[model samples]
Target: MRYLPVLASVAALLATSGVAVASPAKIPVRVVLVTTFELGKDSGDIPGEFQNWVEKLPLSEELPAPGSYHEVLRYNPDLHVIGIVTGEGPAHMASAMTGLVLDPRFDLRKAYFILAGIGGIDPEFGSVGSAVWAPRVINGGLAHLIDPREIPSGWSDGFVPVQGDRPDLEPVPPLHSQWGDMGYTLNPGLVNWAYELTRSVELPDASSLQANRVRYKGFPKAQTPPAVMVGDTLSSETFWVGARMNRWAERWVKYWTENTGTFATTAEEDIAFMQALSAQAKAGRVDINRVLILRTASNYDMPPPTETAASLLKEEANETGFSGFVPSLDSAWRVGSVVVKELALHWEKYENETPENK
Candidate 1:
């Protein structure tokens, strides 16, 4: 009873300190910009997939993201937009996305997820610095492989369906529960709307990009200027190169999507990201239909006519090695920000209804 005065004084001090007595309500996020990596700090340095977003969108607030790849998330308070770096590769992507969706700090049920990053483009589809909007994300990491020397004579390559004994087996084995699905199809209406909105926006075309583009002698699209287009993406942990592997990718995507998906970009994380988001959507934590994947071209998946796969692979061994590196980053932000800004600026309308419905 004598300590009543002390307890009252402590409560008064705590109140004066501006600390809440109860848990604060979770933040309501309108848009989530997902990038794969960032070089150095978030600003005033070499930009990766995340730097332009952090600096240009000016995500001024920092939120602690435990169990995520980068661990710190950037936020634009006024726009209710959040930016995160998931690191590179499939493992990091799976961990980061799963942690983000399950985090209690943000209300993500109605949030729109924009996965914007750079990828190796298929010269048949587009050239360096081209921006691609993917309606289908195919998983390229789940297949069984055999050495080229051991492969059967008639087979195209060594890759085979995980459950089947041969390549391009009809009725590709049903998606396994343990391995998850082989392909994820995003909302077509929303994807088309986004494409229509930014299709005319010009992409950066540097002299270096042009020089590299001209190397692909027989591919007409490879020589053309970069443009915005709708294409499918393939995600794999292995960074494969060469013409044989490119053919494999094209066939794999066609097989998984029943010849509906055309392979345009080769990336390392989208499938894992989609897998996590799918699970979250099932749990009612996120709306998977609102997810958008935007991949920009930093380099070609296979070598040009005069170059060998080994030589091109060696040239692209580092981040700065790709000719379209900077332009791809610019293209990603230029194209993706249009949609992100639209959703955020008109949150009142977009929150309850996605753009597809409009």
Candidate 2:
């Protein structure tokens, strides 16, 4: 009976230590909605990027996320959809994405990732409250920058390509090797399909949005109502503003994409998000091609003719100061939910084949 007691004690220890218990079967996630931040709680408060998904989608279950920026994840059991808030900025986004792909509690191999957020829109390409789908995400921080006062007489601005000595260097050096992470080209077919599917999506148009857009006197596109369009994004931690910075953003995207990408949205996290997902893809944890980026225009990247960049930025420091703040959030959910619903409802088809391939 001494052996029996010892065996019982061992069993107890093993059970307490989780060594004798098998982990629960991993949950199969069909769709992941990634938002950058939340204004308050997940619901019943002023909404940020995450509120609509949590409330409208009705993510009722909470899942523990150990290493993510936001330690809690919201889930909708019926839809097989998961919502994550990555806080904000590049560091938070990278860490949250890495944590998500590495979490063993979920099977994400066939999951579709939708990164939906708001960004500063390029007035030349879009107006506030516009929803943009981007196939190209360029890292705007990977560059050599000098103060404008110290820049060479002929240079446009101080920013230069990481692989070149000057702005718009001829025959841009091949960045596919060491600097490959600096630019990410998403599945073009998928982007185009998403654009076509949601191109006619009518975004919320309010008097505030209209009044704000009219300030861009020379930018015809900015004066028009919001629309769904396909544009490229530039990601950087620096919240740059002004005409010069806008020009640099446009040229930078073109330079990185070999004159193929038009910069429309300026944001802070997509590059890091893509990098993390790319790593997960290599490990076969996620399908990188199933990723989609949607950015709504909460504000303009630069000031209008009536205001200076400094003044505009100061005004925008308050979250509600952006004229399209509420409208942009509405646009994000409106445009993004269409795809989310389709994918969730038709998981059998999307699980085997991405929309682009279909």
Candidate 3:
């Protein structure tokens, strides 16, 4: 489990200088860790404790060396860990991920990925700041624009067709529901560990946990707690502007009602990021069974932040009055803290119990 520091550092330096280093020594798990700017790009606002924990680890592995994929490398020869910050969005994620996967320098026998960041939650979940772990990833942006006049109101139209289209656009496959079978298993041990670790950090309790547990009555274990909420997530290709975000939110709400589904809105890029990893498994690139996506919501899209007036007194008065009306969206941070802790604890348990490692 130990790597030669001198050798590793020398290798890193050569790699950085456009010189290929000797092939990397095989490690335990080849991990591809990804995060987005949603949690603040600097990583300062991330729970102080979380930052400290990761900083203490020897994750300093060289990222993309010249022709390689990523930038920062927190490599630990003992743990066989290399944490890479794949850039933001699908284009960046896909390009960077593919680079790492295809790079012949590293051996990826036991591939594992953790796509962690913040996400926006549905209002039904009480506040916008809650964290969400998506069990299913759906492409909400693929739906077609259906005029009510063209389709009957009361019918459940599985597929809707588009009207006259311009030559510039390729016919969008009828906006139908496409599901990606990301094989990440719901590790009960990990879930429990996350919950306990989060609790240790003093985060708030899950408001919708119990309710969802009841809704999904067929849940295998009675002791296992339920997830936060049930909402469809919508993804967008462009940086979400205030105006467009508002319109899309309205559209998503209407679509949900019409389809009898409650979807929480997100962007389109995550789909590509996730799809790439899923493709690797399908293609036998690695032995990755599944991946867990932890996201934190950064801003409120619909019902944009009110326009600021020049009058200070008027603004103060308005802010005071609206204080009671606003739902704190910052709770997602707390939830994220807890989830991260749980994973750490679960890993500890597995490490202690595994016979080979022992």
User: Candidate 3, residues 1-358: lDDT per residue as tens digits?
Assistant: 2345565677889999998666876444534445543233223454321232245443544433464333444455555555555555667777766776666656654544555554444333323333455443544444445443565555343223233232112332233323432112233343343444443333232443333223323323311332343344555554333433444444443443343434454544566666676666677775434355554433233322243222322422421122111112233334543443333434654333421232
Q: Relative to the unseen true structure, what is the C-alpha lDDT of residue 137 in candidate 1, on a scale of 0 to 100?
A: 92
TM-score winner between 1 and 3, please give it.
1
Pairs clashing in candidate 2? none
Clashing pairs in 1: none
lDDT of 1 by residue, 90-142 (tens): 88998998888877677899999999999999999999999999999998998
Candidate 3 segments exceeding 4 Å error = 1-5, 8-24, 38-64, 67-70, 76-80, 105-109, 143-177, 180-201, 204-232, 241-261, 304-358
Q: Give each model's whole-structure lDDT.
A: 0.90, 0.88, 0.43
What total of clashing residue pairs does each candidate reach? 0, 0, 29
Off by over 4 Å in 2: 1-14, 17-19, 175-179
Among these predictions, the greatest lDDT belongs to 1
Q: What is the lDDT of candidate 2?
A: 0.88
- TM-score for candidate 2, please give it: 0.93
